[model samples]
Target chain A: MPQRYAYLGPQGTFTEAAMRSFPGADEAEHLPYATVPAALDALRRAEVDLAVVALENSVEGSVPTTLDELATGEPLQIVGEAHLPVSFALLVRPGTDLGDIKTVASHPHAQPQCRRWLAENVPHAEWRAATSNAEAAQHVADGHYDAALAGSFAAARYGLSVLAEDIHDVADAVTRFIALRRPGTPPPPTGTDRTTVVAFIGEDHPGALLEILTEFSMRGINLTLIQSRPTGAGLGSYLFWIELEGHVDDARVGEALMGLRRVCADVRFVGSYPRADQVRPEIRRGTHDQDFTEAAAWLASVRSGHA
Target chain B: MPQRYAYLGPQGTFTEAAMRSFPGADEAEHLPYATVPAALDALRRAEVDLAVVALENSVEGSVPTTLDELATGEPLQIVGEAHLPVSFALLVRPGTDLGDIKTVASHPHAQPQCRRWLAENVPHAEWRAATSNAEAAQHVADGHYDAALAGSFAAARYGLSVLAEDIHDVADAVTRFIALRRPGTPPPPTGTDRTTVVAFIGEDHPGALLEILTEFSMRGINLTLIQSRPTGAGLGSYLFWIELEGHVDDARVGEALMGLRRVCADVRFVGSYPRADQVRPEIRRGTHDQDFTEAAAWLASVRSGHA
Candidate 1:
């Protein structure tokens, strides 16, 4: 039997493009859902073998919806990730001039990316949000809006003409998408790997956050991203979404996780997967597995008065 | 002769309030400058004996203007700090209604704090930036703008009526201000103290940041703040502004500074002063001054085969 994969789409969305770029995506069944919740729900209900959703954007930090899902819901194992260069295109009916656009449609994430561009190019246009960029392009095809901001690849599929391509206020923006499945054994550590976890503060103390950070730092692990989100408990309370270098199987990472458990109120293990960039950290001298083993041996000898 | 103090003001800005909160502020000559650079420049040229500037805000993180000044040019010692609760007010001509406002003037920092409120209350108003909040209030008094976002305390000073007070997107936002002087003896170490330093990465490496963090973590010091700013060399190049607990005089802190010198290309020491809230860290075992002293003695004896 073949694996079935679900991604946010009507096809040609950034998530779909990212999903198609995965190593084994071509051999699986590709299904499109209208929103991230729907796609992930399909995987949760076992209707799909895996689901792909955008995790973080270089220009915008983490997607709030995805962060909330990862922080709460039933556990899911992130098996892999893909990076897609995000560039938007303005899609319009053939022969439509930029001045003719009074209302523009786009997904919320894409609006901020091209805010300055849209304000400058079509100063009179009003923005309308859609579920996805490809959905916006479809709405434009159906004459719901004068223009749509979407992937250029989406224009042809939705029977719209590309008015402009590669539009962005910032250059070299990339969105990172991750593939998740029902909790299972994580893929084998690839040496160059990334581990992610959500740490909840045990109590409101001046050093709670610092304690969590020291766990990883003392073991020579490097963090790539750390975001604080309100835990809905109230103001002044926050939970952190942390991504760091190394697989949980690594001795340093495992020790750090144990340290986190002791400091945090409750520690949620998201997943440890191979890093997309494959950049390996230079393991420092005292943080190696052998170093820990040797230190433990030395401590035992001293404790037994046999030094 | 009494000392002269410089702060950003025409009068009634948040900085002035913070300056007034200082223990010896009433004994000094208060001189107001138009901008942060101007106030610091006055001190740099010895025109003013000291200067007070906002350093960081609980809600907004580090103030960019202060960070840039602290990172470069002639170094000054931060001898004391004050934390002020920030709340804004809208000042307008007497008898002016909110609907009568067509333009809003404020310092760049004030605008974002009231953006959502203004959008809901005065959707037609255009935003204008002023150098300081007090300057904005003065402009409104001069009839240059319909309204200004400033402190309520400015209303009486500028002869403008307060349209609204206590305007904030988030409550309990506190801005931390620092008092600086030309190179002098640092304040003696208080049990509760914070030391700040800026570390420049020598070369691009995967764990450069992690290594710097471990130096402090291994010694059981807690970091209160860490912000990474671009070194202006390129995108990946960065310098970190770090504030950690414990004065530079602490044995653990001294060793951590030595470790940082070995790893970083350059480390700039900012003065350590008593914490505003006076929260002391729990000194863990193996990291106290006596622990370091005893360990050194033990090593020396062992090297001489007299252990």
Candidate 2:
């Protein structure tokens, strides 16, 4: 089958890396788009079968465009999700040394991750933003910059040498990207999963928003994230993005979603996918109960309303 | 006295023009920051006595960064606001003509506004995203593109001649910018105006969001726009921005806000001012009635529960 997945870019982007993380990724053609809306438009027109868009990065909170696109009533439905361990590094032309770098170029998303490293190494150098890490790497390759902040994949793709690996200030540098498809073409389940949905309303008057939320709380549904984006209608109302535990097709979840739809103007089920275990079995061999206990505690807080 | 304002760029951004709309503007020193967080940090650190940030543009909706910054736990208070008219035009190098342009470069916000113009005139051309309109103009000057979508102010500043004026599709394009400060130094009421506040959480577990909104309904607080940004904690939680009919200091508004704070986790007043009577008074006369009518209708909706 000729599979097409639309992603934000001019060919190479971190989202493309995330798309490649899909199970049956080999031989899939990638469609590059200038904006998320354009990608979704292509999906609606059936030009692409799927879209891989970045939702949130641990360091950057949420991609408002992704949230907004989901809330804007797209005919596309989210089918699967993947979380890629985003590891950023400083890349430069093949023969360039760290000391030879006068300027560093990168996407804004990369700048924050490499903040500490950039400050310590090139404190006074000017930082410029290119369209993507791949573009930044290309700029470095074209001799526009002595160095660039980019992902490992981008460096390899552009044939640049990594001057430093894993320079992100935070050890937990991860980004969650989602796949979208037309309704009824859902990705097969992988169990231990989660689903995302969004709703829009004008007067979430006092209890309106919560009334919808209670449908999940009463059912013991584990909600992961809730966010809102302005509807651009000039009224102080919103379109909300919400994530909850279990697939939307699950009996309890199905009932909850039905109840939510009745209360919200527009409600959409984005997707259901196996929640990513950032650390694979091989990587978690020795760190067994250490982080797991912390994760459980955080989940408990969320369940108890403290979160 | 050193008054400071923050805009979204290293220098020469449209936000700078909006920031200049503040009263006693000559006393304000422009502080350029790469991101909104940097500016908010300056406000939090007392490094700047006041900060002006762009809240939203009529064509592009609310700026997520500004909304995200407002929702942060901070003492910053909104005390005043201004609506600046936005006029996007196509600019080119001294010798470049309309037909010679193979690409249109602009910030993403300008892209949608100029979509019609681009499609009609530069149909097959590529659209490149620049860091800012000023940067786009600079790139055009640097021969990166034959033309760029820029504001009149940017064209003047960069010495790029305007090839087309008022090319944005929206005739009423305006951006609402707000002035913020630490709690103790709220901007004095210029009188005969309005105020902005953000509220979150609700009284009852079910329909909590709706319950809090009731205060505005009962008190006739006209909400101009309400958007929710992620608190980044868990699902079904958010921070809401609400624009109302009167200043928070007004007795009725004061009572409503006080009541709301008791029911909500936070009821923050961002700022308020007399709504600008005209965005482009000289160019377009007497179109303010449409906005006022819309605002009045929204206010009635809040009161009647139809919104």
True contacts kept of each: 0.03, 0.00
Going through the candidates in the order shown, the clash numbers are 0, 19
For every model in order, the TM-score on chain A comes to: 0.92, 0.85
lDDT of 2 by residue, B128-187 (tens): 999787788899889888788877777767778888887768887888877777665333
TM-score result, candidate 1: 0.51
Best candidate (score: DockQ): 1
Residue range A276-301, candidate 1, lDDT tens digits = 88899889756776765654453333
Pull out the clashing pairs in model 1: none
Tell me each candidate's TM-score.
0.51, 0.45
- Give me the displacement of residue A241 in model 2, in angstroms: 0.6
DockQ (C-alpha based) per candidate is 0.02, 0.01
| Model 2 chain A poorest ten-residue lDDT run | A279-288
After superposing candidate 1, which stretches have Cα over 4 Å from the reference?
A233-237, A300-307, B1-307
Which interface RMSD values do the candidates have, in the order shown? 16.9, 19.1
